[model samples]
Target: MKLGIVITHTDPETVFNTLRLALYSLRQGDSIRIFLSGKGVDIDKIEDPQFDVKGQAQEVLDAGGEFLACGTCLQLRKSGGSQICPISTLKDHYEVVRDSDKLITV
Candidate 1:
C-alpha cells in the first residue's frame, strides 16, 4: 500500500518518530511519502535534544522514502530555502491524500 504521512509539527522528537515509522513501513515493503507542512518545514534548521533529525530524515530518504516540504511553508521560514527536500504545494498534497491508500498526520 502507498501510505502518505503529513508532518505538521516542528518538534524534533516528534519528527524523529514520524520518520522512524516511515522507515519501518519501507522495510515492510510498503511505499511511504512524508510531507512537511507548517513549522514542520523547519526540520533542517533546528537542533534536537538527542536525535539527529536531519540525519534521520536522510536515512528515510536513503531507505527509499519520499519527502515533500510545502512551498509556502518554506517561503515563510527565516532560515528558508533548502535544496534537500523538494518543495510542493497544498494542491499536490491534496492529490497525494486523494490517491493514498492510507493517510496519517503527525
Candidate 2:
C-alpha cells in the first residue's frame, strides 16, 4: 500500500505517534510519504523530553518513509528546512494526496 500522511501541527506526541505508525506501515511493506504543513515544518525542532519526535522521525526515514515540508510554510517561519523536513511544493503535496492508496491527516 502507498500511504500519504499530512501533518499540520508541531504537537510532539501526535507527531511521534504518527511517525510510529509510519514506521510500522513501512515495516509492513507499505510506502509512505509524510508531508509537513504549517507548524509541522518544525519537526526537527521538537524538544519534548518524553516523545522523542526527532528520533522517531529518523526511524521513519530509516524505515523508508519519506518526509516533505511546505516551502512556503518554512519560508514564513524563516526556515531553510531540515533533513527530516526538506522543502517541498504544493504540487508535491497534491500528488501525494492524489496518488496515495490511503491518505491520513494529523
Candidate 3:
C-alpha cells in the first residue's frame, strides 16, 4: 500500500504518532510518504524529549520513504527548505494525493 501522510500540526504527540505509524507501515513493507507543512515544518528543527524527530525522519528516508516539506510554508518561515530533505510545492502535494492509495492528515 502507498500511504501519504500530511502533517500540519506541531504538537509533540501528533508528530510522534505520525512518524510512529510511518515506521510501522514501512516495517510492514508498505510505502510511506510524509509531507510537512504549516508548523509541522519545524519537525526537522525542534526535538521532542519523547521522540527523536530528525533521527526517525532520517530512518524513514533511509527506508526509501519520501519526506518533503511545503516550499511555500518554508518560504513564509524564511526557511529555504534546507531544514528538511526536499522542498515541495502545492502542485507536488496535489500529485501525492492523486497518486497515493491512502492519505492521512495530522
Candidate 4:
C-alpha cells in the first residue's frame, strides 16, 4: 500500500502522532510519504527535541519513506540556514498525494 501523510500542526503531540503512524506504516512494509507544512516545518529545526520526532523521521528515511517539507512553508519559517527542513514544493506534495493509495492529514 502507498500512504501519504500531511502534517501541519506545530504541537509536539501532533508531531509525535504523525511519526508514530509513519513508523507503523513502515513496519507494515507500506510505502509512505510525509509532507510537512505550516508550523509542522518547525519539527525539522529542532535538534534532539524532547519528542524524538526527528529521530523517527530519520528512521522513516532509512526505511525508504519519502520525507518532504513544503517550500512555501519552509520559507515562511525563515529556515534558510541550518534550520531548513527537506525542501519541496506544493506541486511535489500534490504529486505524492495524487499517487498514493491513501492520505492522512494532521
Candidate 5:
C-alpha cells in the first residue's frame, strides 16, 4: 500500500512518533511518504548539537522513506538552506495525497 503521512506539528515528540510509525510501515514493505509542513520543517534541518528527534528523521530517510518538506511552509519559516530537507511544493503534496492508499495527518 502507498501511505502518506503529513505532519504539521512542531513538537519534537509528535514528529518522532509519526516517523516511528511510518518507519514501521516501511519496514513492513509498504511504500511510505512523509510530508513535513508548518513548524514541522524544523524536523528536517540538520545541524550540530542535534537532538534525538533529528536523528530519528535521518533514520527514516536512510531507511528509504520519502521525506518532503512543504515549500511554502519552508519559505514562511525562512528555512531555505542546506539544513532543511528537500522542499516540496503543495502541488506535489496534493499528488501524493491523491495517490496514497492511506493518508494520515499529525
Candidate 6:
C-alpha cells in the first residue's frame, strides 16, 4: 500500500505520532509519502524530549518513507527546508494524494 500523509500542524506529540505511524507502515512493506504544509514545515524544529520526533522521523526515512514540504510555506516561514522537509510544490502534493492507496491528514 502507498500511504500519503499530509501534515499541517506543529504540535510535537501529533507530529511524533504521525512519524511513528509512517515508520510502522514502512515496516509493513508499505510506501509512505509525508507532505508538510503550513506550520508543518517546521517539523525539524519540533523539540520534545519525550516524543523524540526527530528520531522517529529518521527511522521512518531509513525505512524508506519519503518527505515533501510546501515551498510557499517554507518561504513564508523563511525556511530553506530540511533533510526531512525538502521544498516541494502543489503538484507534488497533488501527486501524493492522487497516487496513494490511502491518505491521512493531520
Best candidate (score: TM-score): 2
**Per-residue C-alpha lDDT of model 5 across residues 43-106, encoded as one tens digit per residue:** 7553434346777776777778887888888888787723336888888788889999999999
Positional deviation of 57 in candidate 6, in angstroms?
Answer: 0.8
- Give a tens-digit lDDT track for model 1, residues 1-106: 9999898887888888888888899999999888888887887776876977888888888888888889898887644456445788888788779878999998
Worst 10 residues of 4 by lDDT: 76-85
The reply for model 6, stretches above 4 Å from the true place, is none
The 10-residue segment of model 3 with minimum total lDDT is 78-87
Q: Rank candidates by TM-score, best first.
A: 2, 6, 3, 1, 5, 4
- The candidate maximizing lDDT is 2
State each candidate's clash count: 0, 0, 0, 0, 0, 0
RMSD of 3: 1.4
Q: What's the lDDT for all of these models? A: 0.82, 0.95, 0.82, 0.79, 0.77, 0.93
Per-residue CA lDDT of candidate 2, range 54-101, in tens? 999999998888999999999999999988999999999999999999
Could you tell which candidate, 1 or 4, scores higher by lDDT?
1
| Candidate 5 collision pairs | none
Model 1 pairs whose backbones collide: none
- Writing each residue's lDDT as its tens digit, candidate 6 over 1-106 gives 9999999998999999999889989999999999999999998888988899888889988889999999999999998888999999999999999999999999
For residues 1-106, write the lDDT of model 3, one tens digit per residue. 9999999887777777788889889999999888888998877876778878777777777777888889888888988776354788888888778889999998
Regions more than 4 Å wrong, model 1? 78-80
Pairs in steric clash, model 6: none
Can you give the TM-score per candidate against the true fold? 0.89, 0.98, 0.91, 0.85, 0.85, 0.98
CA RMSD of each candidate after superposition: 1.6, 0.5, 1.4, 2.4, 2.8, 0.6
How well does model 4 score by local distance difference test? 0.79
